[model samples]
Target: MFLPIGQVKKTGLSCHLKWFEQHEILPLYKAGQFPNALCARFIPERPDVLAVAAYDGSKIIGMAGASADTPIMWQIGIDVEKNYRGRGVGTYLVTLLKNEIINRGKLPFYGTSLSNLHSWNIAINSGFIPAWLEVETVEQENYYPCN
Candidate 1:
């Protein structure tokens, strides 16, 4: 599997969210929730927010993203299509993104649901050690973006 860094162009927020939703990984898309403008905004105008797309020639089979909120604190996220799992795409993406994070003088890390063995394994394979964890739930009626 080849992990290639995607172009850091200003992609539409909705477009990226659509990709996640299409995979059923992002069940909810609250305006202030995961991948929201706030989350993407948290990442400044720099390559700090690494967005890489796994490709089979021209088709995107998977994706991985990361950002460093602070000098030494970073967060990473990844996903692969259902039919593309177990082919090392996820692992490769994570590894490539992790290296990119480190290159920017930040620590590469990830957080996943305890029930997701695949995510856990990918994190481990990408050289991220489980250092800590926390959980939270918020009640909100306005989920997706109003626009």
Candidate 2:
């Protein structure tokens, strides 16, 4: 579910959030500094991928982007520079991006490992609540099928 925009907290640090257009996204992608996971899933060439970046003056300090997984579902991801972390960058970016996605008539969701408390906190602080758990298992070649 999408949370109300007014509930999201503003970043403590001085920065501006900008929704990167396709032209801007391409340069960031080519620079090889965008989040690897986001790049792997959301190619810049794809129209379904959208990005919102946090800039501290001329430099990009954080990014929150989403890619459509289905007609209505979009997966969101965030990345913050090491020096800028712990200053509410992640929370601000995700919250801004999430609201933007929702405004576009799509659903945005986040996923993180249980052990990663930092990520979990960012999600919660950004107005995301626990939704569903996901797991993956590999099948052995020698395993027999029971019918």
After the best TM-score superposition of candidate 1, give how far the Cα of residue 12 lies from its true spot, in angstroms: 33
Give a tens-digit lDDT track for model 2, residues 106-144.
877887877788988888888888777777789888787
What TM-score goes with each of the models? 0.60, 0.77
lDDT of each: 0.56, 0.72
Candidate 1 worst ten-residue window by lDDT: 9-18
Candidate 2: the clashing residue pairs are none
Clashes of each: 1, 0
Q: For residue 85, what is the lDDT in candidate 1?
A: 81
Per-residue lDDT of model 1, residues 86-115, tens digit only: 877777777766776667667666767788
